[model samples]
Target chain A: MSLIQFFNVTKQYPPNITALDDVSVKIDKGEFVFLVGPSGAGKTTFIRLLFREEVPNRGQIIIGGRSISRLKRKEVPLLRRNIGIVFQDFRLLPDRTVFENVAFALRVVETHPREIKPRVEKALAQVGLSNRARMFPHQLSGGEQQRAAIARAIVNNPGILVADEPTGNLDPATSGDIMKLLEEINRLGTTVIMATHAWDIVNSMRKRVIALQHGRLVRDDREGGYGYEA
Target chain B: MKLRTAGYFFRQAALSLWRNVWMSLAAAASVAISMFLLGAFLLLVFNVNHIANNLQSNVEIAAFLQVDVPRQVSLHIQDQVRALPGVTEVTLVPKEEGLQQLSQQFGSEQDLLAATGGVNPLPDYLRVRVADPQSIQSVAEAIKAIPGVEKVNYGQEVVERLFAVVRWLRWLGVGIIAMLGLGALSLIVLTIRLAVYSRRREINIMKYVGATDWFIRWPFFLEGLWLGLFGSGVAALAVYLGYRLVLNMVGPAAVFVPLIRDQGLLLWSTLGLVAGGSLVGALGSLFSIRRFLKV
Candidate 1:
């Protein structure tokens, strides 16, 4: 059964700009999907809509068998708790240590204090950053910073992980390691939807691919390779 | 909320304040200045009202009897004036005693009254005190209607002017205080807005991580509360000290001038100012964070 479904969703910005137009797709639970497209191909818009950050102008988006398009303002936070999000910039509190950064997610959710320490330690260990927990974001390398961000994202044990250009700023070797980490996370029965422009990484992964161009889904293939060249 | 969560909020609030120590101090200082000015004006207005009340209470109508009226008829006129509504007391001042009092008041100029050539020109009068100063005019009119009373003089023009001035000053004081209050409120809002602006990235991250609006709001609220508390608390201390100093300096010199020497009243007012400042600070922070919460 599909864990996520988009039924003819449309999104438009102000002054006659269509960011995403009439896109539809579905991905089942435990699937790892790569969103491959150019810079203005509505990939970010798609992730934003999935997270309920932006509402579709038309049609419905169903995640875990529920329509999120009409979710109330107060219920938005609850909806967001079920999905972990990662970004290219690796947004972390500069003044906080890696351990505190991961624990921040649980702290904000008002989780039991005793549960937060173990959960954060587990997440940091998963990202292979258990020993780097004492370092601040500014003191960490770009790859280490991204690893900490990933740890923060997964600390709450979200069912769905949506990453937008998670390895966009890393070297090829570092990006490869990050991809392995994500694949490991996906292997644990969590759905992972990643948007990236790294063609080489996409081709090697042999994951399900969804391509978009000019706000329209042009192609989707099961176990597809990167079609576009560097 | 649980105690642990409350503790977390306070810790976060204190941490953020410490991180932005300079900004926090600037905001607190602004609040202190505004509160201090408000406190000073309040004291001034209170003392002015006190002195005005003292002056009004001492106001009495002096009804000079007709020169030909006998002592028995003068006494009867005094009783009639005293029987009027709002008239609290009436005392007769015989003409000889009035002349003697005038001579004493004249002091080194006593010989000026010698121009009367041993003839007492001053008329015997009834000193009429009223229950309410507001009713002094009506009571004086009632005294004028009694037989054998020559003229009822209560310095009506000067007294009315004084009352009008007092009323105007009271309104002016209120207007100034309201403006100062607004000034303090906006200053707090601006400072908190800056605090929110500096933490915009943290706020965005919190939103994405499913943090409730209130969870994000609590720290800013506490920050504003601290700013207001410290600012007004300092102002209250300054106001108390300044009032004490003023009382000491003025007490011995102006013994007859009724200053507001009530310690309890000042204490209550300063405490009230601190509480009001804190409320304003909290509200200001809430207002500042509203725009940022949209994320």
Candidate 2:
């Protein structure tokens, strides 16, 4: 069964501007898919819809074979538990240490206090930041901060990882490193749906690419290049 | 479901309160001032009402009999009046007994009575004490219809005026208490709002992290509660000290005014101050959280 299915989904903002138009797609488990588009090309909205942050104006979003369009407010948190979202800003709470930031996910999910320490340590080690766990977000380099954000995102071991411009503010080398980390996470059986405008990184990865333009799906290919032409 | 969660919130609230110490102190000071003023007003009202009640209890109607009425007739009139409804007690003062009591009251004034000793001019009278001093007027009117009773002389105008004053004081007390309660509530709300505003970023982060509304709210609510409890505690202490100081300065003579007699009122008022402070804190928190936790 598909991990996520968007059936004829369309999102419209007020004053009659459509963000996503009749977009339908299916993503299977363990597949690494990159959503490539320009600045206003509905990429963030797509990720938000999957997280239930923004409901689609028309059409259904099915996650794990359940229609998520009608999920109750109390059920939204439970839905978020199954999905990990990484923002371009790296949304790390400044007051918390790197270790605490990652551990926060487990704490919110009410994992046992004794179990939280080991799981947080493991997640930090996987991101190769076990030594810098005590450091705050400001003390880390851009690459380290992004990795810390990824650590927090995957600490709960969610089934799907939705990254929106995860490496948007990073240098080219740092962006490439972050992409590799994401690829590693994807290889470990977590389905990663990353939205980015980095053509070179997308080309180098040679993963399945989906292109969006003016809120419409222009192309979907297994070995797609950064093609802009219709 | 357990109080453990409440404990966590209490700790968080206390930490936050200390972190924002200046604002919390300002809030607490305002609460204390408001409660002190309220307590002072309450004390005044209680004492005034007490004095009025004491005066009312001592009030009685004195009915003077005509001199020509036989001694046996005056005794029969006293018995009838004493048996009437609302008559608590009756004392028959004979003409010669009244004269003798007057001579004793004014010791050397016996010579003045001897100067006019040819006749005992003072008339016999009955002093009636009613269950409620307020019923004196009705009792006097009823006694006027009795035979051989020349007239009934209760202080009708004085009693009416005293009751009027008591009623006014009771209403004033109610009004002041209501106003004070409103002031306390507003002060608490403002203080809590300021605290919430200072922690706005923390609240937003909590929300984005998928924290439930109650989870995010619990800390602020508990903070308000703690503030109210502490502020009221301080006010209650101040009030008790003030009461003691006043009592010391005024001495036992203050009891005649009925203001300082009931020491139980002090305990009850102190308890009220603490309870009021806590209630204001809780209500203020509830009001402030509604705006931030819209979902």
For residue A18, model 2's alpha carbon misses the true position, in angstroms, by: 6.7
lDDT of 1 at B14: 91
| Candidate number of the best TM-score | 1
Which 10 consecutive positions of candidate 2 chain A have the poorest summed lDDT? A104-113
User: What is the C-alpha local distance difference test score of each model?
Assistant: 0.88, 0.83
DockQ of each: 0.63, 0.26
Please, what are the lDDT tens digits per residue for candidate 2 over residues A106-217?
7655566788899999999988999999999999998999999899888888899989899899999999889989999999999999999989988899999989999998
Model 1 residue B165 distance off true place after TM-score fit, in angstroms? 4.5
Q: Measured by TM-score, how close is model 1 to the native structure?
A: 0.82
| Interface RMS for model 1 | 0.9
True contacts kept of 2: 0.18
Residues B33-79, model 1: lDDT tens digits: 87888888888878877776677778878999998888889888887
Candidate 1 backbone collisions, by pair: none
